[model samples]
Target: MSDLHDLFLTCPKGLDGLLLEEAQALGLTEARAQVSAIRGKGDLETAYRLCLWSRLANRVLLVLSRFPVSNAEDLYLGVNAVSWSDHLEADGSLAVEFSGKGSGIDNTHFGALKVKDAIVDNLRAEFGKRPTVDKVNPDIRVHLHLDRGQAVLSLDLSGHSLHQRGYRLQQGAAPLKENLAAAVLIRAGWPKIAAEGGALSDPMCGVGTFLIEAGLIAADVAPNLKRERWGFSNWLGHVPAIWKKLIEEAQQRAEVGLAKTPLWIRGYEADPRLIQPARNNIERSGLAEWVKIYQGELATFEPRPDKGQKGLIICNPPYGERLGDEASLLYLYQHLGERLRQSCLGWSAGVFTGAPELGKRMGIRSHKQYAFFNGALPCKLIMLDVEPRQFVTGERGERSDAAPAQGAAVIEQARLSEGGQMFANRLQKNVKALGKWARKEKIECYRVYDADMPEYALAVDLYRDWAHVQEYAAPKSIDPEKAQIRLLDALAALPQALGIPTERIVIKRRERQTGKKQYERQSAEGRFMEVEEGGVKLLVNLTDYLDTGLFLDHRPIRMRIQREAAGKRFLNLFCYTATATVHAAKGDARSTTSVDLSKTYLDWARRNLSLNGLSDKQRLVQSDVMEWLREDRGEYDLVFIDPPTFSNSKRMEGVFDVQRDHVELIDLAMARLAKGGVLYFSNNFRKFELDEGLAARYQVEEISAQTLDQDFARNSKIHRAWRISVR
Candidate 1:
């Protein structure tokens, strides 16, 4: 292995550590795990070792060159400088993989083309024979990475992504990635647990990746030890003796099982199509006896008889995205939790999911939620401690009287079309139940429904602490206005029943439509009724919007502004009806300016201001807030800026996308602030990331607490709010 050279093995995120172990086992002594890849030094023999044995990696690339590259030209020049002739044969085929970050060059495919051109041009000029481009099954693969104006080029040593564990001759729908499964096991401390002879169970195993990987781990078998070939074997520099020595050591380790106990890995899945494929994979991995597969519903499946040692249970229950029926899915999770409590004790469990609401249905507070990426979906691996049956049971039985009757004929009747009659019944019952809980818990100003739309049919939401609500559309046609009325009625009655004054209640609605322009026909179907509660006037609109009149998610934000608004000058930009500005004014703001382009909304803002006992002394500007911020000389001590994610209209100077101009918008908004002013900037774009550097120009702290009210607390990323100050 003396002829070895520097190499880099890039794996998908979260698999770095596992890949590193495989590299070390293969005699790449210096393999070090980076954030998303591994780098080490090895000869061609070492490369071959990795190709045959790395289970938790995407590909392994051999380092070719590292140079400073500023733009496209710099990238081309750096690629051309590499000695391509030394590696490429006259008739060989090649492919270039390019990834870019923090540079002017944006298109990844275009960058790959430039590198390809450079390599072909360099080689063709030297030998009059250029390599053919082969994307699939290329003879040689080159990787080009441009990060922060610097480029690092390498040769791919692994032909296919390491996730193709070869044992997976058959696949199921959205089968778990091999590398991700391995990482999850590692993160769950599987090695330590397996060492104790703890039985392992995957109750919802789809394709048996977890069971197979766990079997391999228990038997001390490296994941990638059986790969047949590697790209580096064809490279000019090759070694044999030292590579064989490393393989000898690995085989020796495998000859000895980690323990003498019988293999205790088990998997269960109800899907008929997945059962055979799972068995096939296990058999191919030669773990047929060590691992067992069962095809049955979890309701009937029982754990294997307990051994002296306690075992571990892990599962990835189907989220609503892959499955449907929220109530059904929730019931599944709830039952799974019950089964764990009943059957498995002295054991730990890990449940991974992107849908938190579903996780909540499990009814057990996780000890820890490990963050990992399941493909592009952000997922959390929740660890639960299910101790022996002797713990916390035989105490509470017989459900509550206030628990709205479920699974009854009433539920079926409620699903039928009856002039919102069944909806009203369900909505009222949900509201009453929620109100009862809130009063018992002593919570006020809570949430009622997420959204009441035809699409979100009868999905009544309930909350006492934070606000989030929604109603999905029913299959059959119903009056959208009547749905809004039913929702508002529930919101209005909730606070009163919960011991909160009707005047203190605030109701909101959210629409998913593209708000590119105002509705061509603006007619008030039903006027909002203002009610009095606790000396404050409560404004509730049952039919004014696709929603009526409240943004429940911002309740926390409103409360925060009120708490911090004493004697401060307040400015509310893009003030849609200015409810927040009213909250600020009630907190006794020195002055408030509500700026917006819509005269109708401006009038509504004025009404909200007056409803809170404020007057024209509070500034109400009917001008474009963006232009106003750019030109206004007035200063404010507190600002509330919440813009649409995107908009196209002649009302403003140009098309606006919050993601594109966040830094500029923040900079300008801060310009009209007093010396020690603070601005609460918010956006509803789910994937919004703050411009940390720009935001850091001022003291910034996230204030998304209001956005995570009880109703919308299920997803923290739904909206993000941050406080920027000039302290």
Candidate 2:
């Protein structure tokens, strides 16, 4: 066994089986799979081949020794027993990485230190000189693993984690590692597809991981051919001739692969900022000629290939980490499914997502589902046979609605569904009913339709020229397939019935949010557009957040503030984006102060003020409204309080539940009001009950009717309002 080395190939979790197969195919003999690792016997050439071509492995480690140890002294003795002089120079630098902990080795840091000490001491004793510790770019990298009562020491043949292919130096926020991306492509049958000269595409290609990996596979290029350094580079037993021969073979293979492979690989990213970075990564990977990235959105995603060329669509769509982020992501997955069915009639799709529940919403039936872990988060790669016959109806029968068709034919069916026509008719009726009123009132941003037809549970609001559509989550009793068809109908009808362009129709899902009220920036594109309300310009970012900065239901409320704000100092509490303050300032308010707990909203408020030229008479403040009211020593003629129903922001001193604390909040506001001043209070909590004790304490009027404008007449319970004044 002198010519063979015991090797362990480690990979991302849940990839042990795949890694085992790849390793065996790469000439690793006696291969067996363990948890997140594969143990095998291989000659030096086999190790080099695994390091070069095995795409699923993270590290290839050659076992040096195995010993039974229960304490630090024994561990040191086991490591020191290896002849340090045989593998490395005494004056060379080395780094030790240790994993697992037990048997008196309580932590990994101390374990690594002990291993480093033993190696250095042994080398110094032999050569009268000590090796230096170089954690970064070390001459030699060693691994120590302690499991239960046994210890295995090894030399890392792959210098870095094999996932770091040196192509992607810049990436998106939640990037899929290169090795994991390769696993997804392999499981998606990309190698077979590419061998047939098929196409490949990723709709949401953040930094182009899938595209680049697929290109390498299609070209038969070694995954690590361009890597310059390895663990064996500085070792004493390193064979330069064999390594040089292997590298030359890889280069020749790459040259042939590059010259002959006519692959159509592309990626589409909505974020404009990432296109250059993705292009740069592709350039670095030497796949720029084979792979191209463009700035396009999921709604408009389409692969550009020659006619009759069907390929694979692979994407790792974002599955948000919290409820606040899910509202927007639900629509993204739906759009992906819709596009796959519409454009790619016979193409295959691989969707990798952590939230498997969201995968079911794609409507297409997956023939197979594979489980893998992105680091520690468990994920599923669902393989879809995207032909018309594979819709996920219980019978797996062909259906008119979900069948793959040409682009125009898909749109025709999308609009011709009985449910879709019904949805479209209701939208037309709503526009006729509300268009006259909206135009007469000069309301640029208003709701035109809010689920008037029970089958279509969507709210379509007009944001100037764009339609902001929100789909309310259907009841669990409703079939998701039926719901999806109806939603698509509604979306298809929106552009035509509402007289808006297809690209301007933005869709969202209305999910019941739970958890702290911490705002999450979901999209990398921080896009914002200005819309006019009450003749005042307000900024609304439609894609970056769930709520489009301005709340449409509060239009009448803000207009009333403007009408009554002449020559009066006003205070606006919880003034998100300060839309109301802008109107108040426009109406010639003598002075104004707007308070909120979020610095982000405050900065937005400042921008709103600046955009409206109202900063001269207003102050945008970042503070808890309760705390600000308690400390302020000012009187105002007009005061508006639109507090959130509940808040658990860490920026606030304590939790805020409006139902329990509204009275105290009102009392604090009243103390700062002038004798004849008016204080208007409001909240969106539907089940809220104003305390009976409030009427007896002061003059109060329920003005919920006045705030219910023509646009929100259908959903009158959207919010509650009140007018209170000192008695």
Candidate 3:
């Protein structure tokens, strides 16, 4: 074999260009960038250099042969043509890694098996003994790629991925990959910043991946310096002398780099449990003195004054793909933006996030944006100049002044806008009118505003002293930008009009939801506030869900249930959080049974019952309402059935469309009714129509108009209610 070898370096997707530059800088000839991999030529020493120093390459492969293969037989012949004894001993262990698909090779595992069989057969035919396969730890590791019937066979020079680096023995949840972290640093211009003796900090560093990588880059330390083994270690072409010389030279360079590198690197994590792992990783990387990890919250994180000013601030905050993450994360992103504006002025900022909209919520416009992939999810690496000028000149090219005059003028203008002022003035009038009615009725939670002005489409509800604002999804005919501007104006005027702190205002976008989306968790904040209405205390989480635990629109219905349930046994179906059950129990019902399929809501129902001093007589059942109705044998004098407009939950047997299945649902609940019993059926399906035939057999009165309270008078179609009894 010649000293020069064709090599293929694989890296994370979207980093091919960076890997190409690194490979060429390492003296690899004819380097060309490909999608997620780079093709180049390097000798034994060049390959060793990459294995030791390349921070962005996942694996460095030494290509041994290439041929056109059309079938499994052709693959076998192509692989068998290589002299197996020249690379691995006949009695040694080996493993084959197969990738891609081509003619007659669809399964990667089968292709790997065939490649293994060819190698073993060739070695056995030459030396009368075949190498045993070692899947865990092998003496020789081979890689085979099949693309459009062309095969490229290579040796896996790096035993494990170069990103492993033998440093991180402990990691936190979703720790950024080391190579990807390095790529982010490079894209953020960290190399130039470090060369100029600038500092770097990661506010939400998880297990110190970015901190350690940045430390290595700043200190000129080889990424794989501590790696004890490689695929070439036991290969027949292993050269100990050349490897030792390269190690010595890298050590000398690292020593000189560490001594004069005036760069400071620090990281902060809110999780105390992650601090030790970060310290352990930094210590193992021989950068303990350079990288410092502090257990602190983002709200309190600040750059160390001793480390100098105006370097780089980079973080990979939670992208929040899980349920209920986006709601709570909005405030976090807003806070991060404020912190940058206040404390990190003049510093460069890099924020890599999977949720780009959430990044936009930061309010700091990026000067440059790069696309990258974190696993399968495409993400953006946003770079911002965290200076006064950038902060003042926002994404809209508008000037934001720091003086109180400018702020007050902006607020005054928003409050005086033709549409905004009318909405604000109407809100004040409603507050005045409702204030008297609420005190007389002893209602602490009620709707204060419901799109009084059509241009400002929002529903503002007061929960005790707090305000919960739900913005209706705008129509496609309206300009979204204009709608957003009006929303901002409304938000600005709400606090002054309602006499509530801005922090007390919770906002959510309300669109038509189907299936189980409305019931799904929107945030994990678990923040709940206690509010009272009609002498009933209910728990409401304004920020953690689409709908607050208690339905404000159903206040009259619950009050009616309380008035009717003197001594009768009551049943509440689809009893979300059992707010009505609390009312029925408080109204002296004999016994109450609440049925729903969600265990979470059932637990919530139990809590609500407990909160109101209700008794064990009120039982919460977790079962599909349809199935429960089929098995129910107990008779009830009063029953309330309020089904969702639509539900396709996996726990349910089939889809439930209220419009299509209302008759069946009504019949099921009516079967459990006693003689002279009343069943109150209601739903929010706007287009609901009653079956005339059933109304003829049973007395059904449309009492929807009577159910509307003064607050919901404007939107009488919010829900429909009916009182049914046996004729």
Q: After superposition, which runs of candidate 2 have C-alpha atoms over 4 Å from their true positions?
A: 194-206, 255-279, 286-313, 320-346, 355-364, 391-678, 683-698, 701-722, 725-727
Query: Residue-wise lDDT of candidate 1 within 135-209, one digit each (tens)?
Result: 887778889888898899988877678777778888777767887888788777788888877789988899898
TM-score of each: 0.55, 0.77, 0.85
Q: Which is the leading candidate under lDDT?
A: 3
Clashes of 3: 2
Arrange candidates by TM-score, highest first: which order?
3, 2, 1
Ranking by lDDT: 3, 2, 1
> What digit string (tens of lDDT, one per residue) describes model 3 on residues 1-727?
2478999999999999999999999989999999899998988899999999999999999998999998999999999999988899999999999999988899999999999999999999999999999977899899999999899999999999888998999998888899999999999999999888889999889899998899899989999988998989999988888899899999998998878744789899999999998999998999988999998888887897484556999999887655334344655766687777767867899998887666665656688999999999999999988754455333243444443343222211111345556677889999999889888888888898898788888999998898888888899999987886687557656777888866788888888998999988877889988878767788888888899988888889899999999899999999999999999998999999999999999888888888988967998889999988999899999999889989887788999988888888888888899999999999988888888777977899999998988888888888999999999
- All-Cα superposition RMSD per candidate: 18.6, 5.7, 4.7
**Residue 559 shift from truth in candidate 2, angstroms:** 5.1
**TM-score for candidate 1, residues paired by index:** 0.55
Better of 1 and 2 by TM-score: 2
